[model samples]
Target: MVSGHLFHCRKNSWPPEEYVGRTALQLLDLDGGSPPEQAWRRRLNSHANILKEFSVTFMEAMKMMTLGVRLWSYVREEASHGRKAPIDPFTRERCKPSASQGVPLGGMGSGSISRGFRGEFKNWHIIPGLCENSPVMENQFSIFVSRDSGNKKYSSVLAPGHHEGLKKCNDSGISSWDWNLSGQHSTYHALFPRAWTIYDGEPDPDLKISCRQISPFIPHDYKDSSLPASVFVYTLVNTGRDRAKVSLLMTWANSIGGFSHHSGGHFNEPFIGDDGVSGVLLHHKTAKDNPPVTFSIAACETQNVSVTVLPVFGLSGENHVSAKEMWDTMSKDGHFSRENFNAGCSMPSSSGETLCAAVSASTWVEPHGRCTVAFALAWSSPKVKFQKGCTYNRRYTEFYGTSERSSSINLVHDALTKYRLWEEEIEKWQDPILKDEKLPEWYKFTLFNELYFLVAGGTVWTGQDRTLDLNSPASTSC
Candidate 1:
């Protein structure tokens, strides 16, 4: 124990009677005046109680009037009892998140995807202003690595394994996926429209992966920012002596929201877009004469990287063949087997067989070489329909048109093409605040970080209203 001892000291004191309860006139030192002025002051003091009553209720007035005295007496009493005043009950507790969750994945009024700080994709908020908290088991990002021309292999779902088991054993007999990265070795950084995750080769040990996830959440660039899309750019670094064959896999389910699946015209088909971008389109049959909602998962093919697509696969249970087939293909050579694509191209007939799609971008990284792979997830749910009634086109539809005029493939192309401009605008918006020395360091983070709630917090924005010009006589409405 330390040598110093603690002691308590108390002072027994009280204010003089003249100073205890003084009127405004006495406090203002206005008592000394002529006889007429003294009469006027007296009249004003007489109405002081009425004025106080008008300002506050009787109970509040009494509380305010006696607060100092009550505090003094309470402290003296507590001191006499050899104890300090109790801490405020309100301050004894605070609200905190149950897990490490930050940086949502979409833009304002355009829906969003929520990811935990540990790299697990948690909530899917595709429908405008609605959120699904349950995690989609098949909606994930996995990586595959093969070293020395397939002598050694590594593959995982890029997050910690789930505790829950499969719904049931499928005919192919596969049980679960390889969810295998520990949060201890990985780091996630988030600032509004962009987030970065660094995977430090805990299991693979031969290659390191860094993923930068970007959404067009730029300030003042309303058109691109309002689109429901996000991009994932993976940079792979090979540190070993041998060349490593690497594949970055992105798997997403065809499900958007539970409420939108009542009619059941959901389907998936392969699509090869303009810029060597290839993937599948998830078509949903929505209500009204409006065109169906379409979603796409695609990857860009550069000179060194080749893009592969698995149009349809089962999420889990009763289709273990799909999961096993996918895992085996990725693990063996950092690519899917040719037979895995379009083999099980069938529509969902029941609740158990939920359709999911996968896209893989494969490349070979030389010793001490770096490669980058880019993927985009886009959706075009043009019309927002409520449960009971009323339907309106989304704000982004003003720029890209409604479902009849636009598709998710168009979104994918636009997102991949213009994302650089979004980044530039985002940096322009954030640079000054970040560089300012007058602001506290924490405030810099708090400034942009808190804006996530505006977009991800079930926000809904519709088309602008038609304004009438007041200057012209014809513009004025009766």
Candidate 2:
């Protein structure tokens, strides 16, 4: 037994002050038919009695009725515009009531009744087209639905006519079904294949090493056209206790044409450094006495080439091969020609005229052993030029364990030193001209005249005005 009022106030008195003055009170107030005040008072009293019979406090029962009235009032107001509740304060967005409110559970005595009320309430009060289970709705409804509805008398105060249209709308439709709602469901789709290429030994070995294109002549669609061509080298070393005879096998393929070659086991010779990039080496011959120690093949443009090394002899005839060292030896020895290493191919229009080079390296060494290899790729524009007969100009030259260079200060210092030495020599000689402070006035005037003629490079007469009048008509301007 519960007691509560289910009527709505015309306005929420607790709304912020700014909003309080803005919304019309007429819109907020509930018109619970005529006899509104008396009806409400009587309903409230009846709810209190019901709660008292159930051992509930009168204050608790009043609180329940007030809460019910608050919720129902909000519902009625919202149903008029197909809204369940005002937008949440935190989210600042409207939300729908939960569907569980309208779903009846089995074996629950009041479940059906609760669901019926919830259905009527939701269909009439909540905003149309809103998702009820949305995060925002879950947060808001948790605050709205926990209060008791009070006594049935208070609930009856809600206008039946106002909820009639809402109930009809709820009864007309079923919940929308989505296949993706089930966790077990998945969608199958097709996708492009992503493939990778792997190679043995360094892709770009020493500059001297030569690599000839072996397998696929055309590039693969997945491979970049700008990638430079490369080669894979394999070397084998044999270290066996007894005279051993074995055969070696090799396989290769091109990406476009598929695997192109396979070699049967060929007799192997006992060899030490013979198969390695460096070190003292030895070799042995089979009954055929001739051992095939080294082999090389071209690589296709489409696919990367790979090589594997294995000895045919048992433990007593043990042998090791280093693919990296072999490539390094080949590179350092200039096995790869300049033309092969410098393949200046053109780029596509979409790529523009820019040029690029790519170099990759891989090194392998026996455990507990020292090995070194270098790989490099150098590229440049085809339009670049190399100047011939070029001479270098160095400002400084090393002498006496120090740098000697000529600069402005050095020139000035040397010139001043020479001038001082000359002055000393002149003083030592005590020349009359050097000692004389002044010359005769006639001699000074003659010297001045000679300087003037040398500067002007012509003769002229000066009047009292100190202006010169030239004898030649051509010199008049000067």
Candidate 3:
């Protein structure tokens, strides 16, 4: 009894309020189990009406608005983890991404899915490619090369030039796009626009290329915890309508140099690690003997997302060879492995000009299927050792999975499922929530206050006028 008196408070009691009417039990009966969204909203309408009737500070008004928006969301648990439909909702007709019958990728044990002609008509958003996490604000990368501050993280995945991307999409079947969510609800965010880039080269039946952006939400523990690191996610896929198999051979541009400088490649010192992990270490200095700094690209392959990285080399005395030429010559038999000459190559340079090596990776995908490759970029000076390839998977346990890759795949897959389900509801409520025509901004709050009084107690507007009646007849006592 003493311990309880000293340390505990009553769990069943209602918290104290400045203006109170209902008892604890009464309030519990009114707002329990979220019982029917409309019924609950009706309970809050009375105070909302009073607030609407009087002018208040913006901060106070926003608090009320936040409550109303959350009540309107009305999302349930069952819908969030639902299965994904095979076909996308936004596509027009179907996608038959055609490409040249390109030669297989040399020494990478996979063929190339060249950038090709996408079908004549296609929807840019709602295409395939899994994603994780969102980034906003001016970081180091965002400051210099990427000028996408303040916009949604999903928007950054498209070409930096938004207007040109759309025209190219229409005229030559190449498109760029993104997703958006606001007013602070998980389900609503899922309904945001999904944007990606399309590189449709020509109409060939053999190969295809598609790119999509994703801004993943970190688990609460990771987001709130001090992890001391950041993650940037970019996802791409290979899709084909007729065949059931396709391969993607991607030659990464000089990652450190942004996207344009391909000849003086940005990566070197390639190495493979245990599991489906590959990495390259980059280190160089200027002529004046600048201090050496290092950057790394560690590629990880999950079950449905495997990748094979191979080094690119050239003939003796030659600086480098075209990836196309190397692919055609080395993959003549339709297969190759690390035993090939260029398997572990790197640029041999002291002045940082000649012998610049570019690295690439390939993945085999199902036709109309997807392959997500996640790379981590970190800086560790020459004094610090580079992180191993498998480290990326460990850091992103939710994406790479705790036990199996299926669980990780389901994380974003289920989110997309919920978004697709809520798409129609969002359309219905867009105008109402925007405060333009359907309902004035103040009315929704007033309605909320009216219901709030009814549920709390009949104290606000119950009729209690006084009156008395007179009778003429009287009876004798019995």
Q: After superposition, how far is residue 83 of candidate 3 from its true place, in Å?
A: 58
Off by over 4 Å in 2: 1-344, 347-355, 376-478
Residue 463, model 3: lDDT of 12
Model 3 spans with C-alpha error above 4 angstroms: 1-195, 198-241, 252-267, 286-290, 302-306, 312-324, 327-336, 340-347, 350-364, 367-478
Instruction: Tell me the TM-score of each prediction against the true structure.
Output: 0.71, 0.11, 0.32
Output the better candidate (1/3) by TM-score: 1
Worst 10 residues of 1 by lDDT: 38-47
Clashes (backbone N, CA, C under 3 Å), per candidate, total: 0, 31, 34
Ranking by lDDT: 1, 3, 2
lDDT of 2 at 307: 16
- lDDT of every predicted structure (CA atoms): 0.59, 0.18, 0.25
In terms of lDDT, model 1 sits at 0.59
For model 1, name the residue pairs that clash: none
lDDT at residue 4 of model 2 (Cα atoms) = 23
Name the top lDDT candidate. Answer: 1
lDDT of each residue in 130-182, candidate 2, tens digit only: 22221110000000000012111100111112322222212111111010111
